[model samples]
Target: MKDAHSNRVLLLSLLIGFIVVSLFVLGVRTLVPPDEGRYAEMAREMFASGDWITTRLNGIKYFEKPPLQTWMNALSFTLFGVGDWQARLWTGLCGIIGVLLTGYAGARVYGPRVGLYAALVLGSSFYWVACSQINSLDMGLSGMMTIALCALLVAQRDSATPTEQRNWMLLCWAGMALAVLSKGLIGLVLPGGVLVFYTLAARDWQIWTRLHLGKGLLLFFAIAAPWFVLVGLQNPEQPHFFFIHEHFDRFLLKEHKREAAWWIFLALLAAGCVPWLGVLVQSLLQSLRRTPGAAQERFRPGLLLLVWVVFIIAFFTKSSSKLPGYILPVFPAVALMIAHYLETASRRSRSVNAALLVLLGAAFLGFVPFMLRLAKRAGEDLLYQQYQPWVLAAGIVALAGGVLALVFDRRLQRDRAVIALALGGFFATHLILAGFEPIGQARAGVGMVPAIRAEIMPTSTIYAVGLYEQSLTFYLGRPVVLVDYLDEFSFGLQQQPALAIPTVDAFVVQWRAHAAAGVRDIAITRDDIVAQLKKDGVPVRIVAADARRIVIANF
Candidate 1:
């Protein structure tokens, strides 16, 4: 009875700690550009327009991805009034769900201690923590995919009753459906491909019969098919662009323009698993010793996990378009595998973890001066200098935790040692991410918003020329008319020719007409364009200027 009470206390403490930490950090930093701002604006617009079926960006028809994330973001905006932290609620919640689900799955598969450790490992991993706090589609997709994968593993366990197995299978299908809604077809493709590979590799053809296919398919289509069908019917062009351009062409061609050498993902994995590298390497080696054989014939979850990791890496490696977060779906599996290994390992593994933590701490502390030089070289010395204290604090905390873990290991308190190291990792990673506030402030255009907002009323015509600040639309509380610029939104403009000015000369003509008509109009462009516009004899008043951009209004 006492042991159970202690276990409950531990679980409650961890849950509360995770929620508090996640909430505190959610609103502390500005949203980063490109992914964060773009997705958030999409959601903001969704809320503004109240059109949930068709996803639009800056009031232009955007069919690149599905609207699952946008829907949630819109819902969050409706409930929480559309601030930075509110915009990020879906992602943070998904991440939390992912961690808890991983722990639960781990507990069921390995044991309670292993489950808790797996959750801790995932929560502390650099990529996972950073992605969870930002407004990004990857976290939502990764979290849903993790749920789908973990559900499959739990359902396939031997101890489940026939009825329980059916229910678990339904959960798996629902997870995949939500995942598909989160990103696109890749969610389904990745998991289905991994399953096929596992089936063939393990020579487990009979396992197919165990899946409740009929009911599962009905459930999947019920959740995932409605949006695709509804959206496609409303926008005829969506079917072609989404399936072909977004999926096939994105993978087969270099059209998305995110091409990178194969080795980039390798670097990302190493950096993402920092402080756990040594333990993970040893765990993987230990995992390899238990191959699928007759001795352990009920099921080989480890082999399944290995196949999951290998297939995802290989699949994305072959794709022409790649990003660092594309491989996140594999992380939960990696955590589970590591936790499983840790559960059965000797005391030497704890020593290795402590050593890795010490190495990480020493590296951070020892290279402080060098990091400052690099920061200076990158022309971000001020931001880096301000960030230095947090970096040092993270290092000191990590070193302290490592030393504490070592002491606990000596006292034969394995769980305490593991928890100490896990807490160290969590704090260190969050500190580094929080230190990015200065960088985000400078680059994300949050500072420029208030000045620009004061100069232009809600009724004023605003044009973003030559460049797009991804966060500008959200901050301004409305869309900016794009002038002579179309990158990713080219398809939208092509479909609706009236939404943008096609050339600078065209914009000049419009500007003169608006000025003549006594209309208040603002244009945001690069500083060079402002100079050229003045030289070309256009009447303009500079409203605000940042280092990289200038906002001009017709005089």
Candidate 2:
């Protein structure tokens, strides 16, 4: 009994440690561009402009994603201030909440020890932890989906009373609603599909009767509809583009250019699971059979988990729009299965997991040089060199963890072994992310921000000529005039042509006019554009420059 008590305390300690480190790391790195910077800037723009109805990036309408992440991020900015950590605050909380939610559900459905392990597994995972610190929609969506998943797990168990079932199902519906707001329709589609498939596969149609669907759907719509209605009412084109182009077309067509082999998710799952990957396949196999205690219950948690993971992976695998983050929502369900296996795993199995962690860590160390050589962009070699020591340290941490886990496993201390491996895995993830700061700093145009900030006047127009650096715009606290740069913003630009200069020739004419008027205007463009401008005899004084972009002014 004392040993069991000690184990529980130790698991709780590890869970707390994972969360503390997660929060601390939120402020450790500069925001990475494309997703992190793009989302952060949208929140910043919405916060600054106070036009929460329509979201804009660089002063152009951006409808690529639903606004839950942006809304939460904007709320964070409102409560705190606009900064890197502030931008990531929403995703971080979602991750932490997810861990807690999964843990609670596991305890309710499985056992207390299994619940703790589930939380530790999910909290320490590379995909979940990394996305948590990033200011992106993936973590936000996954977090909400987890709420739905866990709520259903707890509510549908034979152990749950009538009142508990009603309340938890309502919460489950609400979670799906917020999830829809997080990314898009998949938030509802994936979970609903999982339920349908689970029903068919389990051959338990009567389980549907217990779901309280009428009240649940009402709660779902109440939470999910207002924004869709308002956004669609104000902008008529949103309904088609968001529901059709973003969802259906994005799934069926190769226009996104994000297609990959059907097995891409399989690869990601293995890599993302890290130390836990050793037992992952076994866990999935184990889930195929009913649990020891669940035979009496009509609603099977193991079967539900199996269906959840398989349904999500298969759903994304079929979609042409494939990305690494698309597979994130499945990890929490994977964690629960792995946790159940770990609870009763043989000593030999535990030892093997420890040994795998050591090998993985050493292998990572061996790849450091190749990682350094992967700097494709010019001037990034130095940044990669700076990143080496962190990766080396991470490998060492992994090695240490494996050794400790091996020691604990040999002693027949299961939870201790598990905790040691989890700490090592999570800290290794934190180190790699923290180490990426040098690269992130460069990509975000960090050094040039100060120079550009100094050059800005209240009336000065900022132009993103043939380029747009999302983080740079956010840091400057100002919007830029789009000069012949339209990628993801193309749809938004189609509706508002006045927001951007259509061509470089047109931009050149405007630049000359501004120069003649003695009005200071800043333009961020590529080196080739700077050369072309100088060749064309357009007046442009270089103020600041980085590897990817140059900031120029008409003074």
State residue 463's C-alpha deviation in candidate 1, in Å.
Answer: 0.9
Worst 10 residues of 2 by lDDT: 1-10
The window of 10 residues in a row where model 1 has the poorest summed lDDT is 286-295
Candidate that scores best on lDDT: 2
* Cα TM-score per model: 0.96, 0.97
- Residue 60 local lDDT, model 2: 83
True-structure lDDT of candidate 2: 0.89
**By TM-score, how accurate is candidate 2?**
0.97
Q: How many backbone clashes does candidate 2 have?
A: 0
